[model samples]
Target chain A: MKTKPLILISNDDGITSKGIRTLVELMSELGEVVVVAPDKPQSGMGHAITVNESLRLYKTDVFEDLGVEAYECSGTPADCVKLAKHHVLKDRKPDLVVSGINHGSNISVNVLYSGTMSAAIEAAIEGLPAIGFSLCDYAHNADFSHIRGYVKRIASEALRNGIPKYVALNVNFPAIMQGEIKGIKICRQARARWQENFDERKDPHGRLYYWLVGDFINEDPGQDTDVWALDNGYISIVPCRFDMTCYESFPAISQWEL
Target chain B: MKTKPLILISNDDGITSKGIRTLVELMSELGEVVVVAPDKPQSGMGHAITVNESLRLYKTDVFEDLGVEAYECSGTPADCVKLAKHHVLKDRKPDLVVSGINHGSNISVNVLYSGTMSAAIEAAIEGLPAIGFSLCDYAHNADFSHIRGYVKRIASEALRNGIPKYVALNVNFPAIMQGEIKGIKICRQARARWQENFDERKDPHGRLYYWLVGDFINEDPGQDTDVWALDNGYISIVPCRFDMTCYESFPAISQWEL
Candidate 1:
């Protein structure tokens, strides 16, 4: 009999978080699961890797009930994937890599700052088919029950048909409060940006400190965007690529007098 | 008379590093320069923002000799840009935002892991014209003497002819050891990835730790790539965009049975 496919899992949220626990449970039924995730929360870490410091990987029974082998890593989500690929898994290549079931949305420009997506992007860089799942909610105990079936279906489709080369699927679901998700729509990242407002405060020592807070502004009105889909109660699947080159702008830059 | 163009300078390298110092010196000649960089080295920080903690920014006299105003912040490169725009500069919009004369190259996929490019990308997201410059050499005291003219010319052209909207220039220079620098070329990021090898070792306390090490493997042979231009002694300028959507892969994903 053919062995079940091996699925590697990780997230920006610490290994013990509800999100990864949900991911671990969901992935167990699909394949043999191995998890390597951060020991602490690393949200907004982007595509960071720990290069200046040494990393610790401690084997954990975080998913003991699921009979899954897991390791808690003292690094970013990207570091977890690197260590998993180069050290933990060794010669055993995973059939699929899944990240998040994230506590927050990674729609539009947030993908640039999402630690959850970074894990999936890092895996994609290693030529693995990867998907990062997120719900449009930020509560630590956000309800993920509504999207479990969709997540499983998406992952199953990915394993069967395979994702496009050099791309990672950024799958985001409408919040549970949105009632039933209309459906899934293949979309492009909407043009958006966060308008930062630094909340300045004085510490006990009278030293000034600031908190980075912002409001997200969607600049694109296209119906084909992920933001539009999510707003309309539909799950959005934007195939993200690491190649950031703007080919259309090449001619404008090429005309420069260098 | 037109006011001098306000130029905000930052880098992944700390404020005191020779790379940022070189950048500050070059930018000073072009316009009014303001420096807000990390207090310590932040190489490979990618686009991380310090969300979980409060950030401290202190006015520093490190660039006083150049008569340029500067501040050092306890944050990543992207954080410095946000702080610069939202808090430090407040209402005085910069005409140009320049990051780095980075001590190492951010070519190909390295751009994703580059803190240097993150600052520029952050600026682009804010609707500001920006450029991130890097050298092929990784030494702390790498020579900046060879590329001064090229750097100046590039910045001049950028100020004269605004960069395409929502695009930031990723400019890289061949190391000084490559002899006299050739002309510049507008190119795309090459397809390349780091093959990571974790150097595992037992600590003095008998706990195992690992360090990330990697070899850059260029998988693209296209002559119009940034890697090719730098390899052939040409400075490469790749216009990078924040949108990570792989639009071409939409058809394949659209057919998924979701």
Candidate 2:
């Protein structure tokens, strides 16, 4: 008999968030779930690792009754994946790594600063098939129920057909669409950015400080972009890679008089 | 009179580091330099932004003698660029943004998790020409003298010839070679990753914690790789982009039965 596939889970949100809980509940049915996630929220941590500080990993009973082994880690989402691969699972490599049912959208340029996507990317870096899921909603009680079927479908497809070399999927769901999601669209990341405005305020010390505030601006209005797909009520799945090289620009740069 | 170029400088190491100081000193000769860097070292910070916490920015006299305007920002390298562009520079935009003469190398896969590279990527996202420079040495007192001439040449070339659209440069210098350094090599990022080994230890209270440690392993042995160039005593320059989309993997993923 084939043993159940071991699925590793992590998220930018803490282990206690409804997002991870929903992810755990869903992934448990698919395989033997082993979760190693940040002990606290790690939103916007990107690919950060805890190099200057030491890390602590504690076994948690969060999903004990669900027969899912879980651990809470004192690090970013990327660190959780690293510890899971190096320490938690011992020598048993995971068949898949799934990160988040994130509280907010990680579409377009947001992926660069997304702890959710970073976890999946880290898994991809290790040659593992991985997926990161996010919802358009930011509320703590955001509805993930609507995404369950689609998540399972994507994960199942990934398991059956291995993810392409050096690639991972970044899947973002539209906030509980009134109608069903209009299927999935594999698209490119939109060229977009947050037009940042720092909110200046005075502290108790009478010195000034600023809080980062921004509006998401999708500069690329092309229909083939993840931003457009998400806006059009489709779950957007972008193939992400760790190789940052711009192959197209190489020739031009090589021609420079160095 | 020729209008001097406006150069923006930042680094993963704080404003006070010898790396940024060396960069400011060198850049002042080329143009009017403005330094906005992290208040403390932020290695492994990747593309993280300060959202949960407030930020502080203060004018510093660290570069006063050099006649370079400088500020210490309590944020990541990316934040420094954003803040410098929006708040500090006000109506004036920088001609170029250069991040780091970093203490350590950001070659191959290191660019993905490098705060130095993230700064340059942030600039590139705004359609600005940018470059991130790093030396192979990691010591705080690492000698940067040997690479000064090369650094000036690269920066001058970049200013004389604009960087290709949607790309930034990731430049890594091998630690001060015994012989004169070889010529610069325009290369692709080698497929490489750190093989992590967590040093497990017990706390005084008998609880356990782990220190993140790793050895970088370059899997690709290609001659045109940045890793190969740097290993062979040449300065490596890789054109990098913010788009994480793996275009080559798109067709294969589009066929996934979702």
Candidate 3:
């Protein structure tokens, strides 16, 4: 009997989401699992941390399973990763940090606004190899069966061989039946955007309200992008990082008079 | 006389904060200024946009004395930039977007968690040149007599010559006497972070609370970093981009099996 790898799992959909439930089940086969995630849904909180407020973490039982430990955190996904590393796992760093089976896609421009991906990126900042997973559907019952085996295989492989420093994978799976699934394809995030549409409604108290609604528009028709991969029924895997400097432009600005 | 550049100004601090007010006042000398800032402070929001909630925007008379049009937005700093472009300044796109004279510095890793810098990044994403400014002191009325001219010069120069696409500048000013100013230096963001310390407190009702308090730990002491420039009494300017990809590692990972 060999000691298992300590795997830390987190999500943007709070502790009780079906997405994380599925993720936890798959991750359990790969290693010893510890879950630390937000208590409330944190959909679009990009790279946010709990700096001005106190964070409350509760010993939680999100899954009624055997041999797994979990805690629900009252903060952003990024905060969960930070606390998990420093406060929760003091003896040794986790083998890997995994975030999401996010309810929505974090492809293209959405990557900048994703709480799920930010958790993964934050883990990578602390020298932990990380992965953020998303299904291309926002519905609560979005099909994730197609991705279960692939997810398990991916995590198992990454643990066996370490990832590059300061980098994480943004993995998105197409929402389709398991039988119809195509093999996974390593891909780049497509250049895409949300065509903003805000719907206004009147409250019972005569106050105005609005809900964010958008149709994603992908202008990048390149066959190599993550968007294209998912569209063609393959899982998209884009390597993302925290350092956002466009170093190629460094020399061009150095010539400027300040 | 031809119309001056239409500059959109905002900050994570609420409309009434001294930081945004100072920014608007200084920008008034350089261009046609219009402010759309939060009605309440939104520190540490970190690229957060108000997508999940209704927005309330109302015109304010605060900047009428300076002959600048202003509005108060019930949203995050990123929302102010979006609303300014789509709803407020629909006729003409802003010549520039400027955020902050923040109560504290937004250098290095702080930029990753800054709503002030996020406002600038949002503007850069929208194809407008932008800048975020911060002072080292966290007081509401920190003496800011120094660096006023530098703000005017930098904003004017950015307007005079357009910035590179998808890029913005993060500028930090030293907290010092008016005559203690040095020149500006274009530099890279230093590798830095907050040593996480969550201050726990008890409410009057015996409820537990926490305030996010910590010391900033700068690990990089490179001579060409923004931290170095500010430490040397010079204004620090770091060109930042929204693309979070480490392109140099792409090819290496592309060779790996998916």
Best candidate, DockQ: 1
Per residue, candidate 2 scores C-alpha lDDT tens digits across A62-174 of 99888889999999999999999988887998988999989999999889999999999999998889999999999998888878888888888888888986688999999
Question: Residues B1-258, candidate 1, lDDT per residue (tens digit)?
Answer: 998999999999899999899888999999999999999999989999999999999999999999999999999999999999999999999999999989999999989999999999999999999999999999988998889888889999999999998999999999955366778889999998888899989999999999999999999999999999999989999999999999899889888888
TM-score of each: 0.99, 0.98, 0.94
Better of 1 and 2 by lDDT: 1
Stretches of candidate 3 exceeding 4 Å from the true structure: A201-209, A219-221, A255-257, B200-209
lDDT of 1 at B245: 94
Give each candidate's interface RMSD in Å. 0.7, 1.0, 2.3
* Cα lDDT of model 3 by residue, A1-258, tens digit: 878898999999888898998999999989889999999999888878876668887778666574679989899998888778877786678999999989988887678788999899888877789999999899887777778888888887788777788889898888887877787777777766555665667889887655556678887888988889888888888888766655665775665566
Q: In model 1, what are the clashing residue pairs, if there are any?
A: none
Minimum summed lDDT over a 10-residue window in model 3 chain B is located at: B245-254
What TM-score does chain B of candidate 2 reach?
0.98
In model 2, which runs have C-alpha deviations exceeding 4 angstroms?
A: none
Q: Which prediction has more favorable lDDT, 2 or 3?
A: 2
Predicted candidate 3 versus true structure: per-residue lDDT over B69-185, tens digit per residue: 999988878878877876778768888999998899888877878889988988887778889999999998887777788888888778877778778889899998767777778
Model 1 C-alpha lDDT versus the unseen true structure: 0.93
